[model samples]
Target: MTETITRPLSTEEVSEATGIPAGTLRYMRHCGTGPRSYRLGRSVRYDTSDVAAWLAAQKAATARGGDAA
Candidate 1:
């Protein structure tokens, strides 16, 4: 059996993908209002799937007349 490994994304990379600033990502993390993240050593990282899931959840919430982000 073989296993595939994926490197976690940093704040800057996630910001580039989502158009949210790095600082805002950090703030959202602090407020517990954003996508899930894990502490890798002293750096924070986000899983790509988690980011996608969070975006989908936000979109669904907005469609239901709720605020996203």
Candidate 2:
């Protein structure tokens, strides 16, 4: 038997990897509310690094009481 290795993720895959539900992911896409994503033809993808950066920004904002701003 052979095993296959997968690449990091596309946007939908990233949402699943982060346990963020699809509907919310779609809303985020619509609102531009989440991590930066790239479009490939008709598909959108997110870099793992971008997701991490987004999370770090969110945490820093919360820690600095800048979340609501």
Candidate closest to the true structure, highest lDDT: 1
The list of candidate 1 runs beyond 4 A from truth reads: 1-3, 64-69
Task: Give model 2's TM-score versus the native structure.
Answer: 0.67
lDDT for each residue of candidate 1 in 6-46, tens digit (9 for 90 to 100): 88999899999999999999999999999999999999999
Q: Write the per-residue lDDT of candidate 2 for residues 1-69, one digit (tens) a residue.
A: 896644546766877788888778777978998888777677777767788898889877777544465
Q: How many clashes in each structure?
A: 0, 0
TM-score top scorer = 1
**RMSD in Å for all candidates:** 5.1, 7.5
At residue 19, candidate 2 shows an lDDT of 84
Candidate 2 scores a C-alpha RMSD against the true structure in Å of 7.5
Q: After superposition, how far is residue 8 of candidate 2 from its true place, in Å?
A: 5.5
**Model 2 clashing residue pairs (backbone):** none
User: What stretches of model 2 exceed 4 Å from their correct place?
Assistant: 1-8, 63-69
| Model 2 poorest 10 in a row by lDDT | 3-12
